[model samples]
Target: MPAIRPQTLNDVFQQAANQARQKLPELTHNQQVARLYRKSLKVLSSWAIDRDIFNDEATKIRARFDQARGCKPEKAIRLLREAEDEIFAYTHPDPYCNPVMPGGSKFMRNPPLPMDVCFPDGNYPADAPKYEINPDWSKATPENGKAATGYVLVDFGKKNME
Candidate 1:
């Protein structure tokens, strides 16, 4: 049997990008330039780890944008396209993500159990207890297999849980 791979944040991002591309409207020259600038800065951030160094590189990027600020529309479009290509080429293979955020090592490590379990017939029994919070396992019975008390529940999404 083929192994089922869990979807990663990269997969999520790729899907989003695909959708965006499919539905993308034409951008004005200024919007294109702004997008390229933001993308370039993000690429630079991933490449330069040190704050001092990143600041220096970011300043250089700002200067480059400043230099092109008054270009004619035709030239600006060309420059924006080139800048986009450059940013894409320099993008990090594995960009840094906060440990708790998407694409990070600890992301979704411990997902929450379902709010309620369904039997093979796809419905809860009439006697099934409704729970607003988590079951207090301390008061659970082995034979009855039920909790006698409730605890506050904290639920993050399967993709967001840690």
Candidate 2:
């Protein structure tokens, strides 16, 4: 095994100075702003369905960015973050519209089958048991009760525990 050498305070300072001397790549204020603007536009384009509407919205977004072109670094960053938040809140890529299933959205490749073809014997059951809510609370076992009480009754209609 090689012998380990102890480093002094001078050596540590020298190493830190060397690291400080080496410049790291960093984006300028304008460059960062422009990049953010372009990214927001791309996101908008992906969410938009109509070409004309997208163009109109993109133009408006560009104009907003341009208005804050001369703002200080801190102000610019704040403005950009606010813009991002507003855009995200206003536009949702996944809207609760028609589903992507066979009978819903146009994107589905498989055609939906007719009810008769899907269920040949008809979906309704010949003898289905009718459901009824039991009013008796004392019959409940301690293991199944919400509380440690011997019997706890939960009434859905009353929306309370007894």
Candidate 3:
């Protein structure tokens, strides 16, 4: 697995949830949007369920792994429910920490610039009037090579775009 720690994941999830929550109120309340919001809540609840909170799964699995393992019913499901309740703490906040809920993109006519797109080098040229990923996009990769960090700049010059 990656270097994901509980603290880091919580921070990331909290930030994303905050952003999503911020976006939700801006959306027009309607049946469809409401349904989507409910669905996202369901997803959030599922993520809240954890094996670590309650060791039932581990206990059962461990027993099974044993050569003379004892067969027993899993009480882990109860632990999972408790985990869900705890996770709901962050989710219940006005600025949510979960993406499952409705948010900015879902509500906006013109979506806000995503925070993830902001990079250290810069997205817009200094001379450019507007924010863009690259000043010249059609050519090969920028002479600086490219960021192996997954995202590459998409330079959109101000006057060039409609």
TM-score of each: 0.53, 0.38, 0.19
lDDT of each: 0.69, 0.63, 0.42
Winner by TM-score: 1
Q: Please write out the lDDT profile of model 2 over residues 17-74, one tens digit for every residue.
A: 9988968679877676777777777678667779999999999888987788787878
Stronger candidate by TM-score (2 vs 3):
2
Candidate ordering by lDDT (highest first): 1, 2, 3
Locate the minimum summed-lDDT window of 10 residues in model 3: 153-162
**Candidate numbers sorted by TM-score from highest down:** 1, 2, 3
**Model 3, runs deviating above 4 Å:** 1-72, 95-162
**Global CA lDDT computed for model 2:** 0.63
Once superposed on the true structure, which residue ranges of model 1 sit more than 4 Å away at CA? 1-22, 109-162
**Model 3: how far residue 110 lies from native, Å:** 5.2
Backbone clashes under 3 angstroms, per model = 0, 0, 9
Error of 1 at 24 (Å): 2.3
Worst 10 residues of 1 by lDDT: 153-162
